[model samples]
Target: MGPLIRPLRSFANGLGLAWWARVQTHGPDVTYWFGPFVTRGSLERELPLFLEDVASEAPVSIDHSCLRCRRGEPFTIPASDG
Candidate 1:
């Protein structure tokens, strides 16, 4: 299989993709804060652009499951020093 087609092969499984955002409007200047977790990088980049396009939108969704599972004892601890 050609490398170019690899990207298109996932069309059948779109949900598993890191982030799937579809901007339908550029009228809102509001930012949607979805998943400062899995797609933080992508969210940071697209959020501003999306808001620049659609400022009227709100209720931004920060929908990420990466942190949801590690809900127990969420904080990291340093190793003990003797």
Candidate 2:
């Protein structure tokens, strides 16, 4: 086990899907917001403030920032898939 982020573990478990199961099903469009970041067989942070954004009625922007590397990694995941 790793020093997995507890909120993520609980949230992922709440979805009733294994870590890899989500990947196989949703692939890269996998919303880490309220989704899991599995680290070495365990989970990490459950995307703080992300779920709130998801539930909000306001518009959301994915390209607002380059989150992962903060360098805009030049990757994109389509919203239609989500």
- Per-candidate Cα lDDT values, in order, are 0.35, 0.33
Which residue pairs clash within candidate 2?
Answer: none
**Residues 1-82, candidate 2, lDDT per residue (tens digit)?**
3566566555544554424211111322323222333332332243325434543534332312112211111222334632
The digit string of per-residue lDDT tens for model 1 on 20-63 reads 33333222222222322234455456556544644444424322
Candidate 2: C-alpha RMSD after superposition:
12.0
Alpha carbon lDDT at 17, candidate 2: 44
Off by over 4 Å in 2: 1-36, 39-44, 58-82
